[model samples]
Target: MKTAYTAALSMLAGIAVGAVAIEGLHAQSTPKAYVVSEIEVIDQGAQNAYLPKVTELIKSSGGTFLARGGNIFAVEGEAPKRVTIAVYDSFAKAQAARTSPEWKALAPERNKAIKVRSFITEGLPN
Candidate 1:
């Protein structure tokens, strides 16, 4: 009887551990948010001035740049003058970063520098 009881307890403990591990794995697999910005610089001088400020704002908002305007070979369609991709913790955060007061404040300056088409999409779990 005692041996049977011990085995049952061991099984329960194993099940509990497995449940916790699964929960942790699920949490880690939560999808992130990605922001893609396609920009066409109208004024090089203005764009140069706006770059650093916008870059700093993005970094401060928990965003990590996956790509920021470098050499590109278009596989199909023509590419924009510049492309920037950033990943945020979640969709809400990504949207918030784009619509935040700090970002809105820069609209006048950013508009003067470049024309941008930006969107946010959810990323796949890794």
Candidate 2:
């Protein structure tokens, strides 16, 4: 009876340790989300007017800019005039930022001035 009880406790302890290890691994493996925008300035005047407001809105929504208005070279496909990359805490946050009231209010201005192709992608684990 003693041996049986000890064996059961050992098994439970092993399972607990294994569970913790798996959870830790999962946390480490979680990926971040990136919001990428490819923009073409159809009307430079209008785009210049609209950019500052939207840039502030994005910053308020927990977004960090990785790249903005830099040189882009196309390896295979066509490249847009400007490429913007922003990282959010998660996919949900990225979605929320796009749909936020402040961002929505500026949509008309952006649409009038620039052509934008934007998407969210899962980034590799750190």
Q: How many backbone clashes does candidate 2 have?
A: 0
Per-model CA lDDT versus the true structure: 0.93, 0.89
User: On residues 1-126, what C-alpha lDDT tens digit does candidate 1 reach at each position?
Assistant: 999999999999999999999988876787899999999999999988999999999999999999999987888999888999999988888999999999999999899999999999998886
Report how far off residue 39 is in candidate 2 (Å): 0.4
TM-score of structure candidate 1: 0.76
Q: Which candidate is the best by lDDT?
A: 1
Off by over 4 Å in 1: 1-27
TM-scores of the models, in the given order?
0.76, 0.74
Per-residue lDDT tens digits for candidate 2, residues 1-126, read 999999999999999999999988876677778999999999989988998888888899989999999889999889789999999877878999998888888888999999999999988776
Model 2 TM-score, all chains together: 0.74
Per-prediction tally of clashes: 0, 0
